[model samples]
Target: MARYWDDHTVYSQPSAEELRRKAKESASTAKKKGKNYSPIMPKSRRGEICTSWWGQAWCRNLESYADYSSRLDRGKGYVRSGTVIDLQIHDGKVLAKVQGRRRSPYNVEIRIGRLSEENCQKIIDKCSTRIESLEKLVSGEFPEELKEVFTSEGGLFPTVREISFGCSCPDWALMCKHVAAVMYGIGVRFDENPFYFFSLRGIDVDRFIGVALENRVEKMLQNAECKSDRIIDEDISSLFGVI
Candidate 1:
């Protein structure tokens, strides 16, 4: 007898419990093999993942791009479920290992264009004029005023055109679940260290602050000189009885 399977029948999807079990099994196996894994866990009991403003801003930047909105939900789920086994950031790119339905993990790479020297200098100049902005950065806060500097055209944050990504998963979508999880993981990383965001853009925070301090000092000296000149002119006019 020849048995034929119906091609039109829909396959049953794995339940949430089954997916979690599979993820845990794979993670345990990888750990036993001495594989280093860096998983993102929700900080709050209510499942709050990103607490810092910088982190939230990073996520918001991704969401603002309508093209990525569709996959963000699934990515968030993967990140929360400990599917992103490891994520590393380098000079101009991020590398990650994401666990999926397959026994083996998927590789993901996210590339962001580095800021040019001219653009870096421009950012330094902008931040230098605002002492509060530097203070906020030091305190791990993102200044509302500096938002324009980063989100503006040709700014620190990568634009849609400047950012590109790839995943080893079989999914053909431009951004697969693995890629999205890694992206969200970056936001969590930013929460832990806001400087990571600047690093991603290849900007040196210390250098930026140093240049801004110099600018501040120069402006102060010029203002003092002008004030002294005005005082001397007033004195001379008073002595000569001139208006």
Candidate 2:
């Protein structure tokens, strides 16, 4: 038997050994049960939980609030130890399974509210003019102006009030360590698919690209008056940098 974090059954305080043991046992049990996992990999050489622009921002947002700061610290260790087994993102929902001392993995579900109409429109309008295409946005390389659009009040990321989560763990705390691990796991998932952010917020990313396409059409129409009806080779060279 191994000591585990916040295990009330054991009087001994938890240690790094406990987390490692928990991780090993959890992984083995999960595999035996044929459960697919989307584990958060260990921190990078820089010791950052998440490396990409979107991923880092998600962690920063989690740490910014006093309520979640302390709770999230333990969750960070859980993620590093690979106790969070599987994480799935759906429209306005994130589902996860975190293994602990028990034979079964704890289920965690987090619901993020949809962005307000105003906020969605704000991102759409701002992103349209700034982001050249969906590829650049999903690649996590975009203009700095988009940052403000995403992080501002009532922006893309959900606020405290807009988030609600629950875990099947025995812990009495409102946000049990198991649930917190899943929360942090969401950030890790972002590194794999940036589009999940929009999906989690229940926003249509196509709108962002649609706005850009519409703008391009408007510009081409304006240019048509001064130039030819069809896009010429010179225009292609200027737009795509291709001859």
For all predictions, the C-alpha RMSD in Å is 5.1, 7.9
Q: Please estimate how well model 2 matches the true structure, expressed as its whole-model Cα lDDT.
A: 0.74
The residue-level lDDT of candidate 2 at 219 comes to 63
For each candidate, give its TM-score against the true structure: 0.79, 0.76
Candidate 1 Cα outliers beyond 4 Å, as residue runs: 1-27, 44-49, 136-144, 228-243
Per-residue alpha-carbon lDDT of candidate 2 for residues 65-165, written as tens digits (9 for 90 to 100)? 67877678888877777777678899999888876766567889999998877777767666655435444775555545577765788777788889999
| TM-score, prediction 2 | 0.76
Residue by residue across 1-243, what tens digits does model 1's lDDT show?
545844455444444455567767777887999987776654642354688766777778877888888898888887777777678877788898877777677889999988888888787778777778877866767677887666777777788888899999777799887898898899888777767767788767777667777887788788776645445544777899998
Candidate 1 local Cα displacement, residue 86, angstroms: 1.1
Give lDDT: candidate 2, residue 90: 93
